[model samples]
Target chain A: MIQTVYIIGIGLIGGSLAKDIKKSRPDITIHGIDTSAQHLNEALELGIIDEKTTVEAIDKADLIILSTPVDAAVKLLPMLLDRVSDFGLVVDVGSTKSEICKVANAHAKRRNFLAMHPIAGTEFSGPKAAVANLFQQKTNIVCEIEKTAFKLQEKALNLFASLGMRMRYMHPESHDKHIAYMSHLSHISAFMLGKTVIEKEKNERDIFDMAGSGFESTVRLAKSSPAMWTPIFKQNKDNVIETLQEYISNLTHFKTLLESDDFEGVYKEMDETNYIKQILNGIQ
Target chain B: MIQTVYIIGIGLIGGSLAKDIKKSRPDITIHGIDTSAQHLNEALELGIIDEKTTVEAIDKADLIILSTPVDAAVKLLPMLLDRVSDFGLVVDVGSTKSEICKVANAHAKRRNFLAMHPIAGTEFSGPKAAVANLFQQKTNIVCEIEKTAFKLQEKALNLFASLGMRMRYMHPESHDKHIAYMSHLSHISAFMLGKTVIEKEKNERDIFDMAGSGFESTVRLAKSSPAMWTPIFKQNKDNVIETLQEYISNLTHFKTLLESDDFEGVYKEMDETNYIKQILNGIQ
Candidate 1:
């Protein structure tokens, strides 16, 4: 029964959602709102949304998705809670969950807010990087559904299903912790790996020459936007740290086996971690 | 001036090298030697090499390249050295260096051997993965050059140069230590990250849903062959352990900041790591 949808921060995730939803639901009015007028203009020209709206312009919409960065999402949630229509549902697609979820939890419209994080993105960002099928076969995490009204959660569920994403409900704390290990730590490792290699190789040509798919895979995060990631690490700091420690410990153990010429032990350890293959079997 | 060259292993690295060398020097006869007849047969069919040869068949070649897994390279080098012509040159493209260099150094034909590692590979392996442009503009690391005879090193210099690779020289020990940090540890971190997520997510559909580009970049190495990587971890265990420890320590420090609600410290730490952006400025 949702008719009008407003998307804030029309960057990669938001813009792509706009594009896909527009492509599928021809009758639903899609309104794009962003601090960047240029992004809004681009989204409009691309027909990603029906039109661009100011924060105040789309106050009547049934659903408002805050697809901004983590810090921005936290900062803007209280204000939107103040102005959102009685039946309107507000969702966020930020990477970090705990802070934003907590910010909206105490609101009078707390039952009207649904905390959402759709896990789909590319190395590239912005409206230009947005694509029609970005969310297809991806996972969407909806944190603390108990805080939202059952009807609002139901509305959010329909939105995710329409976009072809499977949904998981988690506590905000748990979501941040799991993601820190599974996502944020990876970024730090990649950035550090890129930094380490670039330091040793000195000449970019050496990295260009020596870096194969291994280095490329490990360092791909180096190309990620500093603006997006810095806030994520800040928001999910504890979890990110814990996951990083575990990862580093595993690696240190691996090194000790190699140093001692313990081929049998080293091979067995990797073979065990190779159980990761079984784990990846589940990945789409 | 190298007219006839032999390539052992006939997998991605060896086959790709043969194809590129043939493209660059049509008159140079390329001989392929692999323990797997299927691979040797495929190499010929793909025109990756000009002809298939056996151990004795390639004995008289001017140059022999051992492009096999680290385990296989260790086993094959001693045998190849026994048959190498007094004036012939031999090189290896194994992932690990120090052990391979040590095994070859005490051989009577030690002076004829050049311990080399071309820092390039895709996730895919074998002849099918072989592509002609693999080594172009890549790095070819020649280790323990002082152990190589002057004449043989000259030929190695020419061969790597012919492949359009920039050359870096290091003692084999140094190469292993540095590479453990740069290359080996990255794979372990990626594999474990993939495992950890897979373990918790349980549902592949959930992982696929939640996995953004960050997860993909961090887990891409999970697609790599366990056969190829097992020996590498075994060989470079010492340095990998050290690097892993340092990495873990950093993570723990960051985690402590998070637990203490030190948002300022967390933000500042991530900001410092962002300096990696400058280091990677020229890497394309």
Candidate 2:
């Protein structure tokens, strides 16, 4: 039943979805909307979307994806809910979900929207970085799926399923908190690790010359877009702060063990953390 | 001139080097030695080494590679240097250098020893995890090169270069200090990051279900062998402590910016750290 697709943010997540959906559903027309006219233009030239349109023409869309930064999505969701056609369904792919879900909850047309986050990305961002098959075998976390009308849920779920995503449903608050540990804290850890090393690279020129692939993998997330991450951290401030405190405490405890020559404790700590190997095996 | 390679620790690095050398230098035989008899057996079964070796038979080798844990290597280097033939070259692949180099310096056969740390590895360890070509395009940091005889240096350098590695030379003290920032801190950061998230996962069941590839990459080093890292930290305690202090301070500062709601500061910090993208580009 979904025919015309309107993606509100033509960035990495949005553009990638457009590319995948276009490949699978050639009969469907894809309309890309971005505040940056240049992005809309690039999306068109990249063949990611078939048309360009704005909020004024949103009612024509059978499926509308809200893929802006979390803050932008929060502000835009209510306005979008007010304008979408009765048959149209809206879904968001924001990293944080609590704030966006709260905004949607207050809307009269609450049943029209679904809050979902697909755990997929690279350090790179924007339309040019978009690629097909980004979502294959990736977990799609859907929050408050019961709030959306059952038929409209099918349309959205079908979209994700058709693209090879496995959906896991949860509450919006749970999504924000769990993601703080698994995703947000990892980003902060990487960014700060890069900052610490870059600060050292200033006084010593050859530090990077000795840096190996381990350094590269651990700091890879430091290259993520500030525009995308800053808002997620801001929105989930308390949870993120909680995770950071735990991380810093662990690092400080490690420093103490090293300072006091309690290498046995240090070894035990890392050996224990190596349990992540089993967890990561399950992930991959 | 190198015919027999006596590898003292048949773990990831030593076993990997043996596999590659055996492939490219079919005329040469690789003799495996390890505290773990199971590892020696695994190396033989995996075709990573040609013969079993002991220190008593070390003089038969033209090249001796000491690839033990840093603590073990510090204790073993002097013993190997004492027993090595005048024409035999001994080089170590210890993660920390100052201690090992100091140990080698006090010995009469110091010129027969070289201190090197090839920055290539995986989270896995031991002979069963070894793979050929792990050193291809990787950095091999050689410290105290001036202490090595010209011919012995060529013997070691040719071995690394033939395996397709790029070499960087530095003093032992400088190598430890720089690598503490470049390599050691990243491991601690990752191990501690893994520890914190695992603690949270105790209460939150679905935390990793939301973890993306970013989280996995950032914490991959947490899976590295604690036996290997514990000695590296012990041998370079002062440098590791300094880098950990810097890393903790940066994380605390970022948390403060988030707590104080300085979205602008948070954004600026990450934006500045994004410079790592360009630096990493140069590396790959």
Candidate 3:
């Protein structure tokens, strides 16, 4: 019975979801909203959405997807919950979940909102970067699922499954904490690595040619859009700080091992971390 | 003029070179040597070499590839130089350049050795990980090329070109310093990032499901062989320490930005680092 969908933020995540949703339920009419009129136009040209509309027209939709940055999502969730139809569901696909879930919990129509953090993305962004199968077999972490109306939750879960997502239920604060280690720290590590190399390469431009596939893979996340990531860090500041401290501590210990001529300790450190291969084997 | 080739170490780099060299120069006899007898046997069984021979008999080889770990290479280069035929060319493909080059520079047969480091490899290692054309379009950094005899250098250069390598001439010290930022720091960052996330996952084993392609890419190098990487970090300690200090400083600054709610600063940091896309586009 989910016949109409209104998607706010016609960027990579929203536009990609629109593509998959359209394929799964072709009869559903889709509307897209964004601060950039150009993105809405791009989504329409890409056939990711059927029409372009503002937030005011969302009430007529069966689903409202708020895929903006976490800060924007935080401000819009309460307003979206207020304007959503009795049968309509509101979902926010922000990176950090706790703040938005807290805001929604305080709203009168809290049961209409579902806080989600779908851990699927490439370094690329924008409507044009949207692809149909981006979410295929990707994990969709659903936070505060109990706060949503049971029927709306069922519809959301079914829609996600139809789009080929593996759904995992999580509470908001815990979701933020775990993600700070898994996802946020990775982005920061890549950004800082890129910054370090870029700073060095400025003086020795020839060093650029020396970077192989290893450097490229490690720094690929550094190419992600800052507009989307800055707010994620701002929202999950404490957890991010904690992860950074741990990462820096590990690096400092590595330096100490190197300084002390302890190749065995260095080897042991890397040997233990090799377990990540197993953990990530379950993923990509 | 090259008929017999001796590839010491007989692991990933040595075995891979053996594959490409065999394809290019079908008449040459490839002899494999390794500290691990199993690796030498694996190389022989895989057809990466025509024979598994002892290093004492390297006098018959026209080209001797010292592809062992840095510590082993440092110890063996002088002895190999002592035993090599007058026309034989000894090339060490260790990751660090300065230490091996320094050791080779003092040898009586310095004119018979070429210091080389091919900046190409996957995270996988061992003779079994060897693949044909692995060095295709890869950068091979040659240090102290002038120290090798002109005829031997010509043979090695032409042989390398035949295997589809692009050779860049660099001083050993400069190569180590730049590689510290470009390549060594990447491995350390990936290993430490993996360590940080793995430590967190021990408490909540379910967090492994939350990892995405981004985490996978950033942590990919953590799976690299510690036996190989330990000697690399040991040989390039000072440069690696300097690069780590700079990287840690950058991560700390990012944390400070998050602490003070400076979303704008965070955006600028990532936005600036996003230039890595263009830099990396030249590579991979």
Candidate 4:
């Protein structure tokens, strides 16, 4: 029964959600807000939003979605909650939720806000990269759902359900820790792999010719936007650092095993890790 | 014009080659050989080979392909050459070439053997994983091609061409060095990532719920067969170790930057690595 939706940061996640909302609830008008005027114009032209508006104009919106970078969301969430009408629901889709949730914890209108992390995205960015159904069957982790009003929680849940997302709930702290290992660490690994290979293979042609699908897949996330990720690494710095330490320790141990010519040890390690196949199948 | 072809180690790579060869040249008779009776029987039942034969029975084959693990290929290449007629060609599809090529370098019939590494494969293994057109438009690196007889080289080249492969030449040493960065290091990185994440995330359901396509792609190669990769790591030990050191160093540097709150440094590193998008596009 929402009449108006205001999506801040009209980039990939926000733009995609707008596309889905427009398709499922055509009666609801979508307003887009972005720091980049170009992105807002592009979203309007692409029909991703019905109009462009600012924070002051969103006071009348029944639903306000903050899809900006994690750092921006940390600053914007409390402010957005202050401006929202009593019946208006505010949600922030930031990758790291602990800091944002902590910032808004003692706010007078805390129940108006929900923190969510949608586990969906491509390496591509910008409004042009957005597509319908990006969240189809994808996991959407809602942190601190208890802090939100029950009616607003049901409204957000229904919207995500309409978009075909599977919902899971966690505390902001647990969500950050688990995601630091599963999601953020994977991006760092891929970026480092890309840097190592690019630095070693001075002859780029050689990388193109010799590299196969394995290299391509392992390094795919290296292409993600710096603007989006830098803020994420900053917000989730402690968990990310801890995970990187463990990952580096593991890599160093593997190097020692290889250096010592313990072929049997290396073989057994890979054989054990192959169980990831079964785990990955569950995600699919 | 190959009247009969014998493929040793009838597993993923060999079985795939047999499938492509049969499609391109239906008149060519395909024979498969393997130390494992189960593999040989499966290859025959799947029609990946017209017959299952012993090494002794390959004496009359117009072409003999050794598609075994690197260690096995090193042992089989020299012996397979001794049994081939002067008109017959012997080639290996092993991942590492320097050791295998060096082992066969002084054989009397060295001119009859060619060392090849097709830059292809999936995480899956065995004959059932084989599929047609696996090598179509894929790069085939032929090491020590100059050591083979010109007529035999033409025969091998034409056969690979028939299967729609694009050919490239490199000395075994250069091939090993380049592939250590582009190929071998990628596998180790993926395997270690999988190991690290698996160790930290004891609850597999948490990983399943949080992991997205990025995690799936980054860890894909961890599922590769250990029997195939262990020898690869052992044979290219020095180069693999060197690459591992550089990779670890780069990762450590990234961690240091993160610890120092050098957000700009971390941002620039990922931005530079984003050039991998162009490099990966070339691969596709």
TM-score of each: 0.82, 0.99, 0.98, 0.98
Q: Arrange candidates by TM-score, highest first: which order? A: 2, 4, 3, 1
Off by over 4 Å in 3: none
Per lDDT, what order, best first? 2, 3, 4, 1
Against the reference, the lDDT scores of all candidates come to: 0.77, 0.91, 0.91, 0.90
Q: Could you give the CAPRI-style class of model 1? A: acceptable
Candidate with top DockQ is 2
lDDT of 2 by residue, A144-230 (tens): 999999999998798788888999999989888899999999999999999999998877665677879899999999999999999
Winner on lDDT between 1 and 2 is 2
User: lDDT tens digits, residues A56-102, model 3?
Assistant: 98889889999998888988787788888999999999999889988
lDDT of 4 at B60: 95
Deviation in Å, model 1, residue B273 alpha carbon: 2.5
- Model 2: DockQ score: 0.91
Locate the minimum summed-lDDT window of 10 residues in model 4 chain A. A199-208
Clashing pairs in 4: none
